[model samples]
Target: MGETVLYVCTTCRRDGDDPEGPRAGARLFDALRVRAEGAVDLRVEPVECLSVCKRPCTVAVAAADRWTYVYGDMDPAVSAEIILAGLAAYAATPDGIVPWRERPTEFKTGVIARIPPFPAPRPFPAGTPEAAE
Candidate 1:
């Protein structure tokens, strides 16, 4: 099984203020670290930027041979629960194909992008079936 990775934007700041306290992304990572300890097989790593500057708190869920989900406009305090829920759902799937209905509201509404998995070579040509007819 592939490892689920939560890519957090550590550089994101709320209200554009420099704060001594932890940023939203860092806070989310810390919270998840404690909450998911020994429960989920996932990793939370801080990233410099996801390029979604308008959205202060952003996160990306990615795994090998799976779709990558990017969500934005989040609040660490409230969003972690939904994020974790989504992660749980994603982890349960073989190819990480979590249905839209299974995803939490945060994921559904805040999604900035859903990147498809990397392409692989097709087993047979597209016209093979048609040509046989």
Candidate 2:
């Protein structure tokens, strides 16, 4: 129902190496951007950090009315396509809930966090009768 956004930690370096070369997260973002060209429902955004420094090259996927997923320990060169595949599955869902079995192997193993969506309060329960003053 809503757009899926993939947020990558651009400053994350593989193995804590000096950031002289392209960071893995940035490379992943670039690859995903190229793959998602002309896509309206899926978007790629670069971020500075996601607090998963221990697992360099992290990414978080989120969407309105859906659970958010944070993945870590990613190898951008090899994981980019897998991440996109996972995002595709997420975008195809009405609530962005991609089944564990359906997720790409990289995502399946790299998932660092799964956060529940913020609940929307209901005005009233179904089948309730109208209140009279």
Candidate 3:
């Protein structure tokens, strides 16, 4: 019932443009993380390049068993709201599928593609357990 959000830079900033080289994604991720710290379960990460150049800063979310989507050209100011809303929707879904009508069109419009859930994680890996003896 948790989610991980990733803000991917579709295009690296032009040389000498921002000096920081496409920081909107970073800024957005940080804002969202702080806002969702405890109210909800969410994780934010930055990715190298998402390849949607024309759009610039973009973000995406990957849920346990739902459609993976990408949102492009997002304004840093509203990134947190977008992320929090998306997380809420994902958590509410019984099977992690947010209906088309329910999705935020503002963000969903940039969806590059849909992907299945990522590899499952082991509860307790070898050498790491509840009671090691």
Measured against the true structure, the TM-scores of the candidates, in listed sequence, are 0.80, 0.83, 0.67
lDDT of 1 at 91: 82
**lDDT (C-alpha) at residue 22 in model 1:** 77
1 or 2: which has the higher lDDT?
A: 2
Full-model lDDT for every candidate: 0.82, 0.84, 0.64
Clashes of 2: 0
Q: What TM-score would candidate 3 get against the native?
A: 0.67
lDDT, ranked from best to worst? 2, 1, 3
In candidate 3, what are the lDDT values of residues 20-123, reduced to their tens digit? 55466666666766877777456666677777666655777676666677767666667578767866887787665688888777656756666777667756
Residue pairs of candidate 1 with colliding backbone atoms: none
**RMSD of each candidate relative to the true structure:** 5.6, 4.3, 6.3
Q: List candidate 2 stretches off by more than 4 Å.
A: 16-18, 121-133
Clashing pairs in 3: none
- Model 2, TM vs. native: 0.83
lDDT of 1 by residue, 7-104 (tens): 88987777845487878777777776777777656888889889998886899999888888899988877887778889989888877778888888
Please give the lDDT score at residue 118 for candidate 1. 75
- The most accurate candidate by lDDT is 2
